[model samples]
Target: MPETALLPDSAAPAAGPEALDDTHYRQSFGALCEDQVVSATNAIYAENGTKLIEKGSRIDRELYARLVQHKLRDPIDQQIGIEGMVNHESLEAMAAALLDQATVPRLLAASLGRPAALLQPLRELPLPGPIALKLTLMRDRCPALLQHALATLLVAMFLADRANMPTPLRSHLAAAALLRDIGMLHMDPAWLAADRRLNAQERRHLHAHPITSVLLIRQQGGYAPEVAAAVFEHHERLDGSGYPRGLRAERISPMGRILLLAELVAALGHKFGEASPHRLGLVLRLNHRALPGALIAQLLPALQGDVLASKVQVEEASQRFAGVANAFEQWTELQQDMKPGEVRGEAFAWLNSRLAGLRQSLTEAGGPPEQPSFLLAHAAGDDLHVADALALGREALWQLGSICGHALQRWPALADAERDHAAGDAAVARWCAWTGAMLAGLPGSSVD
Candidate 1:
């Protein structure tokens, strides 16, 4: 939880009552650009309700800085309001307006533009008054955060309606969607903007943001109990592959499952345009039993089109992909079993040369991040032949060999061999799975 601090207010100008526009939405903390004057809509009060900035007073740069510097999650966040700023009729309208410039899938955009079907079932639900308002304000403060929240909310609502959940339950799911990631505000902004992958410590911080958001909600009580739990468990996977608390399958709550799917849908919409559902289905298939089958069944309908036969073929190919992946896994294990020693120099050089060639082949074939064209399923009218499958299998083997050999070369000394070998094994396994998925045109499990 963020702690609150009291700072003396800056001196106000003697100029009485500056022209104020009630129509213009009030800004949140840190919203001041350079010379913008702060005008308070509500009486500014600290956590303890002590008078801070007067209602009609003008807030200059010094005061704005002071307020931001001493601000905590409580007093500062509670004092500002950006709700009703957009003045939209519905949450869907607000989401559509907010994401106008964003390239979302047509299905997702349509859902946001006119969510009557999605919102109808949730109409009777009594949401907290501040839910939409807070989300709207968050849009002004952090548009990216708002974008994710809105997408998640839209997906969650759609799921809830499909499940025929009651109004109260829907309310909890909706609130959780909006506030689940609020703790991200405490994270390092630079880490969020970094283009490269996060290191271990940075990943730890990223994972903990969910719990931080939960704690913030707990500290500021008003949200439903299920809301907090759903927020906390949103990152958890049904297969126990997720972080924080690796609760699996039956251990994860229904609301948590909804949130998990919602986040995945939102991410897919942001990454792939029209292919979001196809990509999402591929991911769900890649993970197998990690996510709830029921949730996927519910979501599969909203994915625009149903390629049931194609999906079945993809699943079958995944089985074949799994077999090819196992070969690489076993190969890695065999390498690890070898006695500690320097690999022959000529052999190492030969392996690196072969690895480079394989990587080039993969590139020319448009591999890894790019899946096979018909969801990569041969049954999906793709022309992949036995030779193509053989080449893909060879690519997987070379990929594993390259990873393991690199580990040995990087740490020939006995002291570092164990750690490097473990990393190599993990990397090879991930590579094989990814390579197989790409050949199959299926989404890899790592997409999460």
Candidate 2:
């Protein structure tokens, strides 16, 4: 929709077979084979020309040990076949089914002229052999991921069509959305568990998933470079807050922006269920700096009249905002004593700028930092107003926590600065502790 050209593929060249970490994938595939009918279509061989599995051999847990130990002559996805894998036909059916039931998909379909024509792009997409095999495995193993991918595809196409993009570009956007998460197939299943709190190293591994997916798509061939570029930027935010690479502004491609917004919409639907549309409105309002405004303007028509019917307690919201105010107050006090040239001062300055933005967003959303309780009390009886206010407050708190996490990640020196200035370090620790405790009380709030 933005019409920005695709960024050059400055990412390193696609990884060869030897560089891939396929152990986790092989283990997942093996487990899937034990449950589903999966087998080798050709003889699997190691790099040394030793035959591992004969052609047409049923692959299962027994073959997993053998497969994981070798550096294969070719990628395993190229040689394996899964029964009833997701092909173009099945994918079309899946999209049609989702349109019939899901609110967002239906809205997207109706937004695009002919409701039935929404599936045409997906129907025409080229699913190469290896990509199809990987998708089938994802369907059998990580069904949630597959579901998210399908939802993202519908949203991307809807956005592309609304922007008057060409048919070929629309096809490329659809492909990028659908294949963006395939890299997760190669990641350890444990790393994705909902309750698992990842350390910095684990988080870094998770963040590189976009790069992993780009490599996989490039190596598999048949896709245009635009597809890989869009996938690489799917997790990136326009404000440079996104991971793997902190790209900002027009540095992100037009297709990448469409894909990123689509990904967020799909994820919100999963995270908030019936209230996704409502929560999405608030997220967009607070994050106008991070997401494209024009695309959001187009999306607003669908969100209208989809307000949540649930009630939010005034006291609960009041407390949340009070916590937000207190956190900012502590930071202000700490900032007073900070020197501008030092590392900790620079870190605090960065945090201050982000927090200032958050404060302004909250005020604009009817919950000013200095007078949150007053605003909540005034809107106490109006359901829509209260919901909007509470949603804004919740999102602001979540983002505040996220800012702290990013600071810690971006400035490893923040921890070291503690050694030089114990008092300042203590104050920063106190602020982080307060924010964490406050966020724990919210239903879906987490630091990053």
Candidate 3:
């Protein structure tokens, strides 16, 4: 069992009448939605001080419908703060509470399976007051969003720290992480809640969300270009398979890569109830070619080993295969000096031999590798980058090898930080330095 933290006192629900501040109220107002409770930052009334809706009232579906039908007679913005807007003072308190120990999830604590040290650097990281207020208000409308935002913030901050991202860039990353999925609020609730696989059209609509989310953030203004660009590319993949913009790894900003990885990890946890670091790492592996491997590699060290012995083994094995594939890619690049036909043939031969050995190893280990082998066999080489072809092939093989006999485990959420924690922020200033150090540290292989 791991130690856990409790939610802070300030997280307590606000009851009773309150008025939204007059100027801020209008600037941040939006339409009321079903099941969202909103309040006035300042008292609001109709033409003659007749209160139309009390402050701090929970707007149920029916009330929302009625409010919509009549447009609330008086201007909706003047009458009620539909966004549950919070002021700067409240925002600071709310941000503080997110770091409280009571807020740590138990399962996450168990997964960490070690002493819970405060991430002091993360605690000290600067967050804009307005960003916090905006995100908190957004969370009021979509309750689950806050969890995702917090999770993304945690992971992104950790990555930013590890990569030595700039301080300004780190702030933008945090903002982007919090607001990247804001467009989901505008989608149909039914669609958002559906558990089944989306049809093609539905996926296309969902794919458009990155664009919409960026637009919404821009409308709010005061955000840096880094923030807007990251939000726009958060869903994109390294291999151009991702949506709205099919951007390649080099094309995606560094913050965008971190945001993408963080978002995926957070989503996995939300869907299955627990996303252990190891599992999340495997997700990175399985999607290795499509994602930024360097960024994923940076996060691999943080995952707890052997949470389930076989799962960890599989992840390790997958990582090994990815390495071999990487070697093959580098080898192919060197072969650019050779005849194109010979290079292609040599690449195919190398891949086939590795896949054969991987299959045999999985069989001996009692893991299944047949399906991924077939997929690899079917993949068209002409369309892939030389490196991507090998990377994706290895991933498919590793996926089959890992899933052969074991069920993918979903750990229960026993504990988690209620709010973000403090961790070192120096990475924000030294990402390039770290990158240079890392590349220099890698052992070079002979091209021959």
User: Please, what are the lDDT tens digits per residue for candidate 3 over residues 1-448?
Assistant: 0101111123112211121112322222234344345554344454566565666765554554455345233544344444545543443344344433312223333334432221332343334444444455556655566666666666676677668787666766877776787666555545565344444456555776776666555445676777767887887778665656667887777778888887876666454333254345545666666677777776666554323322122333334344444433443344454453342333234333434544554433323343333323333343222223333433444343222111111111111224221121121112222322333343321100
Residue-wise lDDT of candidate 2 within 272-365, one digit each (tens)?
6677778778888788888888898888787664566678777666766777777778778766766665455565556667888888877777
Q: For model 1, how does the per-residue alpha-carbon lDDT over 1-448 read when each residue is reduced to its tens digit?
A: 1111100012111211121111112334344323343455456766555677766556654565666444332444344433244333455565555345433324543544555654443344334433444454456566777678767877787778768788778877877887888766656556666254454456666777776666656556676678777887788877565656667777667888999878877866676554455555554544445567777776655564522222234444444445444544444454565457534344334433444543344444434312433224444444333323333433344344334433334333312324543433433434433443444453332222
Would you list the clashing residue pairs of candidate 1? none
Candidate 3 wrong stretches, greater than 4 Å: 1-37, 40-79, 82-141, 270-275, 310-448
Return the TM-score for candidate 3, rounded to 2 decimals: 0.52
**TM value for model 2:** 0.90
lDDT for predicted candidate 3 compared with the true structure: 0.48
Which candidate has the top score in lDDT?
2
Among these predictions, the greatest TM-score belongs to 2
Worst 10 residues of 2 by lDDT: 1-10
Clashing pairs in 2: none
